[model samples]
Target chain A: MILNDLSELAARIPDGAKIAIPPSRSGVAIAATHALIARNARGLHIVAIPTSGMQADMLIGAGAVQVMESAGVTLDEQGQAGRFVAAVKAGAIRLMDSTCPALISGLQAAEKGVPFLPMRGLIGSDLLKNRPDYKVVDNPMADGPDPIVLLPAIQPDIALFHAPLADRRGNVWIGKARELMTMAHAAHTTLVTVEEITEGDLMADPLRAPATIPAMYITAIARARGGAMPLALEGVYEADSAALAAYANAARTAEGFAAWLADAPGIAAA
Target chain B: MEYLPEELLICTITRLLEGTGHIAVGVSSPIPGSAALLTRALSNGKTGVTVLNSANLQTLNDGAGELFDRAAQGRIGAFFLSGGQIDGQANINLVGVGQYPQQDVRWSGSFGSAMLYYLVPRVILFREEHTRRTMVDQVDFISAPGTSPPEVYRPGGPYALVTGLGLFHFDKLRARFRLTSIHPGHSLEEILDNTGFGFDYEGEIPITPTPEPDRLSLLRGPIAAEIADPYPKFAAAIFKS
Candidate 1:
């Protein structure tokens, strides 16, 4: 289904929904995130595909997140994620601290329709002790005593991200951001915001077909120009570092964060 | 020749990455990334570098999981890791200080450190801040352990640790860090005063080698332009002159 605007897309993501979002470097649906905040979506469980950045921080700051599961949340060179740090310190949200490959492997298990996937490492880390769901068992194939960690499958209610292009047919082009594809496969529904809608079929072109996500997996699409503002969309644009720096500075305090959010370009414009 | 602290750190890291076939740098690592690139250039493209999040520098095209998969297959030769707290045993805490879940302080949770530290052969631990607060006697939480039990299926572990002040080599068998060399303009006393953990050192500790004139030129020239695409702000600030 083609959504009229980002608000409609945000509406589909109900309160308390488990939503999977890509990292900052990948195509982040910042516009849609703004719409969710404007709608006052609450009690959201955010599954950062492996990690996250400003989008997660903004959501946490807005009190929209109840649980955050990821390897980490940082603002790249801009330093630590201010809101994320504040939230964790205040014990505002439940944090499911995991390694990058652990999250990815969990999602991959869901995509493959498996109960769990075995992985090496995490033998003596506190992360294993904290996560009760992750089990350590003897490797049956090994001749000697060999142990490995098993991560339970993670299936989110929705996978949301922005992309460079999507056809009227709802086929979205993700290019080399294949992790988005993994997220879509592991989620119950996939929502996307794109820069433009083309008339031609994306899969028809041999060159473009490899990177395109078929419409069958994508539940809805919203046309959002410069949707990934402040976060770059690979070939389309570069990240607005000045704006990110401003956000980092403003988000240091609760009142300052509120003021910044209220006057945010997308939220105020809406 | 006079050089910035970051430049010296980069040169030190480059020396550590001497003959590592492929060096993969993780997120938010400008110095190691630069050093990897410098190593590649110095090796005349013999050494491979894969900087995460860089379109031009990254060679992995499969997906985010590909990097880990490659490491598991023993394809990635060297990688970098840092922590909120590091101990004498080389155990790192990227989680936070105090306790787990509900801690007084928290950093961006543990990244790919747990797995990468185990999979990659030469894991170079790098942290800019070298203080008693950071270099702890024991990490509050072991985000990734320095060494695993002998029976565990582990092929790799910490090779060395580089800080703004000096360089230390991790003795995996002994599970201890030995002070290798202090950086120029810094002393053994300064290291001792700031360090919370103890380390082994010979009678006369040597100073870390300064970057040669040619290496400085490479860093300020082609390498700066290459790294600018991913870390423009860092490149601009460091290579401004």
Candidate 2:
């Protein structure tokens, strides 16, 4: 369905929903995250494809995320994510630390409708010890004598992201960032916010057809320009330096974060 | 020949990348990223290097998925990893300090170190700070293990570890780090005082060699420019001299 605004689309996500957020430098729905925070959406189990940065920190700081299953959450060059680290320090959320390949492999399993997928890593890592959910099983197919780690399929309640363009039919043109498509295929529902809604069918054009995600998997569509604010949208704009630094510093303390969010344009005004 | 500490470290790491086919330097790793580029330049572009998110260096069109897929397929020859704490067995801990559930000092979570460590043929563990604090006896958590059990299928593991004080080669058979070379201005006694873990050393250790004049010029010149985009601060700070 076509939603008039981001808030309405954000409101549709129920409390305690398992949501998959795409990684940064790709198509992360920052606008949706702000709306979710504005609507006081809570108890979200945030799944990062392999890892996340600003979006994860924002959700955790706003107390929207209850459980985080991610390979890592870092701000890249900006150093450690203070709010996420603080949350982990206070035991505010359940942290399921994972490897990058494991999360992708799990999502891949879900996309293929498989119960579990066997991977080559995590044999001697502490993740296996800490995460009881992952199991080490003998490779039945291998006549050789090596065991492999089996990751449970991660089927999220909703897959959410932002893209440069979407058609009236709700089909999104993701270009080279196909992980968004994988997440949409794996999750039960897919929610998308586009910077601009193009006129013609995205699938009709041969040049754009390959990268387009058909409307079949999309549950909702909303036009939210500058949606991926603070974070860059690939070719559109660069991640706002002043904003990221401001967020990082303000998020050091809960009070500071609240004060910053009080004046936050997207979150507060929305 | 006199060289800056950063130059020395980069040249030292560049020496380690002699025969590597494809090297991947992850995000926030400016030193290794520079070293990878330097190695590629010296090899006449025979070496394939992919620095993630780097404007000048990355070759992957499909984002992290492509990088991870290539690594899993064993196409990546070497990769770089660092830890909040590194132990005797070469295990790197990217997680926080203190207990498991509630950590006193939490760092950025393990992005792909655990998986890449197991897959990459030569995983170089690099940590700039050489101290008992950074190099612990045993890590609070093991984000990626150095050695897997015999029953586990593992073709890749730690090759060498580069630090500020010196370089240590990880012997998989012994599952221990050996004192290889002491960097200029650092002594065996200083390393002993600082290191929390024990390492095997035979006879008198030689000083870690500085880059040749030609190599040094290349590193400080064109190589410096290549790394500037990904690590502007590091490039400016080190390449200025």
Candidate 3:
């Protein structure tokens, strides 16, 4: 029932926890991202289920300790290391060579309290054989013939996201209401960042609420004013080119990030 | 099959795209990438066409989301699509059978299947091989189709089928497959090794011209030239971070 500050909440999730963060652009929960960046945490392995090519690039550019990335599209127009390329090649990041399926499948597995979840995507792709990190366990519930794909449970210590609106009880709304719905539902502990955090106004038009990320499922509800929505919808503010530039430079490495942090004292982009 | 269908698929698709009065494409779609590049090369980049790069940033001139809708209002212009699997009636399914549906599959097969297929006069179905598998008797699902009946879309069916080994087309009347061209260095037997269905061969299947390797190099080079900031910029951001 007690809401907290953004930086204060992000710091609660101890370092070295496998964190799941949305990539740049599409509905990426930026309030949570800034929370992480603001904390100046290190050795955190972040999983990014991508949306915008540019935004994802920025996460790597800024400082996503490890990227469990997949899907969307190959954003390689020039094939040169933007920020992601430089990071991966330098061993600053590891290539998952997987997509959205991996991210979602893993989450669902964790939510169900099961060892892994069976998914149908990525059958023929070499991703099955190559990634030693992902184990394909055989499904016991499968029918007579074919082998099913079992994705390992991904119980990231925490899940941070933003909803369009929320009530005091933490009822959430995902504007167009996307798989983000499932993600919010699956995380063991959920934290929501919202544009409007009001119970009176939200409950007034109760039917207008998106999915309610029940108060019990939620840990913290913080309000960060003018949070960046890099790929904000029609009426929303466009992606922050300035903030992205700052992250782009700062996230080069832990050391480079320290200097970038030293410079972040009064830096704020609207 | 490292870049197996690169050159052959590029030339075949672009030649079919010869008629697009105005065209726009996505990032790194080798066929579209090459077609757009070739189309621009043909006119020396003088065409009034608008290009949409990977970043969803429209270059030349055009608004977001309007590109797909614009291509629908056409005659004889071409749209490029290829998949690991193709069934009869051509409804390609890129996304998984059932992944969260919306945000589940990253790049679901053909987003605007009938939406554009119905509007565009010619929809070229392309892939690297003709194996009975890829060129199946009928697709497991229809992601996009060349034609449906009247009170429907363009029943004319697919305009062209470009494969790694050869090319084929749907007969306007029969709506069945017809031999159109054979790629160089590939024999009719090699072609037969690919397709799963049967089609009449007139023995006049022309040898498709192999595009110069110089052309394919543009995938990461000067030609691809940041049509959209989404792709390369996005990719760079991902790996580097």
Candidate 4:
């Protein structure tokens, strides 16, 4: 399906759906985030692959998130993610504290259509203690008695992201950020926002074909120029440092964040 | 020569990685990243360095997944991790400062720390703060346990805990920390008074050796430029070359 607008795309995601979003440096659908916040979408289970930045904070700030599973949420060079920090401290949401590789392995299991995948590391971590879903079993292949932790596959209801280019056929050129492909593979549906739609066929070009996600995986697409605003889009643009600094300063408290969100660009328009 | 606190910490970490083959530094760790780069430069480019989110150093094309695969395969030699709270047993608490679900204070959650801490042969735990609240008797939560049980298939674990005050080596067999050396201008009494946990050390603790002039010059010069891309603020604040 093709979405004419951002709101229409955001509307497709049902409340309380388990959603997987890409990491911060990787393209995040910020325009979609704005639309979701405008719609006042609630009870989203946000699964961040490894870690997140402002996108997670904004969702938590809007009270759109119920359960967040991530390795960490920070603003990177901007310091701590204040909204996420406040939410956790206030016990406003359930947190599935995870390590980086565990999240990747979980998604990999889903991508491979496996029930569970045993991974190296996390054998003696408290991450194992907290996650009852994870199991430490004897390594059957080991010569000596050895233990390994098994992680349950993470099959989310939807995968959301921003891309630089896509075609009418729904094929997306993700460049080197291949984690988006993994997320799409592990989720039931994928919704994308792009800066521009490439003419003809993206799969036609030999160089682009290798990095393009074929039309089969994408559920819907929307044109959102500067979609990942404030956050950089790699070659498209650099991160708006001033705007992010302003947001970081304001997002320290609920009241400050609401006030800032009220005047936020796409959010205010929505 | 006068030195900044960050410079001292970077030098200390560089010393820890004297013979390291490859070092992978995660995001937001400017000091450790710089140290790794410094070590690589000192080793005549023999040591491989990977700094995530960096324009030049990070060579992985498959994102964090590739890094994990490499670490699991024993390609990465050293790594760095820090937490909101660290205990006498070297347990790190990256989740929060209070009971789970209803934490009083929350820093960022644990990232690839536990995974890398287990896979990287030399995992150095570094935190700028060395107060009682941070160096707790018992961590509020354990994001990554410092030691594993005898039956666990663990090839790597914590090698040392470095703070602004001093350095402590982790004895995996004993599952405890041993005071190694105190940094210049920091007293052992001060460390003991600020620390909430107990540690063992034989004889008098020695002072941490200062960085050589050539090494210091290298850090402030070429290494500073190398680190500027990923850690501009840190490079600007500390490097004086």
Candidate 5:
């Protein structure tokens, strides 16, 4: 569809939906994110995957999500990664000890219409047995196999991506991706926001557009600037320093984060 | 024929440590521990290894990760890691079975092996096995890319791999493994036999340099921080049967 502005698109992300966003500090998806903000919905559980350190904190600060991150990373400008660790510790959000591959496998299994994907890597870790959300299933196929694998399904309702370049038809491209494409491909519904929108078919460019994110899978696209983090590119900018600071403060204070979110710009429940 | 296996491992590590302004190592990694220990104990703690204060890094130090924070702005120089499967170009995937897609892996590592290995230049690859499976025909996955071709890697590919048998370096001139030296009892044929692929080479592998008792103790006690990728569950799963 021809999305002229952010407001027209933000309406699509209804609240109470399981949403997934990219992990890049360069913020391409912010317009769609701004659009989500325009929705002013409540109880929207945002699943923060792939991102490291500061960007995860930005999402949390905006009150766009209750963060679910595997690791914490301090940004180029910070003293340390924001208090996602603290939030998890306080039970404000859930954390998963993830491997990009395993997360992809689980997501793909969920998206491909499978019940779960068997992963041998996470078999006996404290993460599996402790996290009630992750089910440890006995492999029926393991009938007699000694080291049987389990399954992980239940993908997010929406997988949002921020790309360097995308077309009107919603074909997306990210080169040498660090598992971003894997997560997008495995998501149930994929939405991409990019730095630039091209006129020629995404198929025309061989080096950049080796493979296209087919339109059938895409929900919508938006052309927002500062899309890459650390810069105001046709892509997103780097993690919002303001948002990060707010998150850090909230992580330390005795007051619940809701009060902190009251001051930030995120989706407001009407 | 100067240093023994331990000496060679320690000295080669010391050289890499020299490159690192502020060195860091994860837990349970013997080589990383030895390097830090060698630097302080053997090198008289005079080496330029910056002691970052990021708390996670401190867990290995004395219950503080604050040491990791100190290394943030390229302040920390280098680190070490081990790998089960490494390709011709040094990329590590310690996470799992490439053959099977459906197995649950515990604590899929604390991330950053690929991230750090790709981004960090002076990575020391230390694996106990210098054999076929460990030095594979081809890695099941491209966990990270090595010195991306003729282009000089700034903060890049591995400096060395100290296996139980030998020390291997990727000769940037040819972009392949050249046996600089070997442990006391090993030979070029034994080293070559253990390798999954063959590369350009010379007649003999030199003996690896080791550290003295006082030096070794320094590594074990004062200078070196213990390297541990603590996954108590990995032990549980291995022993389950």
Candidate 6:
């Protein structure tokens, strides 16, 4: 289904929904995120595709997140994610600290419809001890005693992201961001905001089909021009460093963050 | 013929990455990314360089999971990792300080370090900050352990540690870092004073070699322009003439 506006898409993501979002470098649904915050959405469980950045920070700062599971959350060159740090320090949100591959493995298991997937590493690391769900067991194939970590499948309630293009049929052209496909496959529903909605079919073209996610996986699509502002969309545009730097500076304090959020272009209007 | 400290670090890192096949650099790593690009430039494109999140640099098509998959297959030769607190045993703590869940300080979670540290053949532990607070006797949490048990399926671990003060190689068998060379302006006393963890050092530690004139020219020239794509601020600040 095609949503009329960003808010309509945001409205689909109910409070306490387990939503999977891509990393900052990948296409991030910043506009949709703003809309969600504007609607005062709460108790969101964010599952970062391995890792995340400003989008996650903003959501956490807005008190929209109850749980955050990821390998890391950083602002890249901008500096530390102040809001996330503050939240973690305050014990505001439950953090499921995981390694990058472990998250991917869990998601892959869900995509493959498996109960769990066995992975190497994480033997003596503290991450294993902290995570009760991850179990270390002897590999049955090994002649000797070989220990490996088993990760349970992670199936999110929704997969949300932004992309460069999508068709009227809800097929999304992700280009090189294949992780979105993994997220879409691992989630119960996938929502996307795109720069433009083409009239024709995106999957019909041979060249574009390879990089396009079929509409079957996508639950809804919303046309959001420049949706990934402040964050880059790979081939579409470069990241606005000055804006990101401003956000980084303003998000340092709760008051500053609130002020910044209120003054943000779309949030006030929303 | 003068060079910046970043250039020196890049040169040192480039030398360490001399014979490695494909070098993969993580996010927020300008110095290592520059060095990997430099190594590739020096090798005339023989060495593969994959800088995560760079449109121009990344060659992977299968997305984020491919990097880990390649590492598991032993395709990635070298990788870089850093920590909030590194111990004598080379255990890195990217999680936070104090206790596990409720900690006083929290840096970014353990990125790909846990797997990459174990998968990548040569994992260079890089931290620009060298202090007692950053380097500890034992980490509050082991994000990625320095060494695994003998029966564990581990092929890669910490190869060396590079800081602003000096360079130290990790002895995995002994599970300790040995002081290899101190940077030109730094001293053994300074290192000993600043470091919270103990290390092995023999007789007189040699000063780390500065970047030669040719290497400096390359760093200030094509390499600087190339690195500007991913880390424009760093390139502009360091290479601004």
Best by DockQ: 6
| lDDT per residue (tens digit) for residues A3-108 in model 5 | 6666656676667667765444323355465456546644455554533444455454445555354422334233433344344434555444444434545556
**By the lDDT metric, which is better: model 2 or model 3?**
2
Candidate 5's displacement at residue B62, Å, is 38
Tens digits of per-residue lDDT, candidate 2, A1-270, equal 678888888988999999998888788888888899999989999999989998999899999999999989988777778789999989999999998888988999999999999888887787878889899888888888778889999999999998989998889998767888889899999999888888899999999988899999899988888888888888787788888888888888889888988887773212
Candidate 1's DockQ is: 0.83
Model 6, A86-105: lDDT tens per residue? 99999999999999899989
TM-score of each model, in listed order: 0.97, 0.97, 0.52, 0.97, 0.49, 0.97
Once fitted onto the true fold, the runs of candidate 5 whose alpha carbons sit more than 4 angstroms away are A25-28, A34-39, A64-79, A133-145, A231-270, B1-109, B112-241
Deviation in Å, model 5, residue B163 alpha carbon: 19
> Residue by residue across B105-190, what tens digits does model 1's lDDT show?
88888889889888899999999999999999999999999999998888988999999899999999999999999999999999
Q: Model 4 — TM-score against the truth?
A: 0.97
Chain A TM-score compared with the true chain A, each model in order:
0.98, 0.97, 0.75, 0.97, 0.72, 0.98
| DockQ-derived CAPRI band for the predicted complex in model 3 | incorrect
In model 6 chain A, the worst 10-residue window by lDDT is A261-270
B101-148: candidate 6 lDDT, tens digit per residue: 878998889998889888898999999999999889999999999998
DockQ of each: 0.83, 0.76, 0.06, 0.76, 0.06, 0.85
4 or 5, which is superior by lDDT? Answer: 4
In angstroms, how far off is B7's CA in candidate 4? 1.6
Report how far off residue A94 is in candidate 3 (Å).
3.2
Q: DockQ for model 5?
A: 0.06
lDDT of 3 by residue, A103-169 (tens): 6667667767888765432333334444565654445554443444566877776666655566676
Stretches of candidate 6 exceeding 4 Å from the true structure: A267-270
| Residue A229 C-alpha lDDT in model 1 | 88
Candidate 5 CAPRI level: incorrect
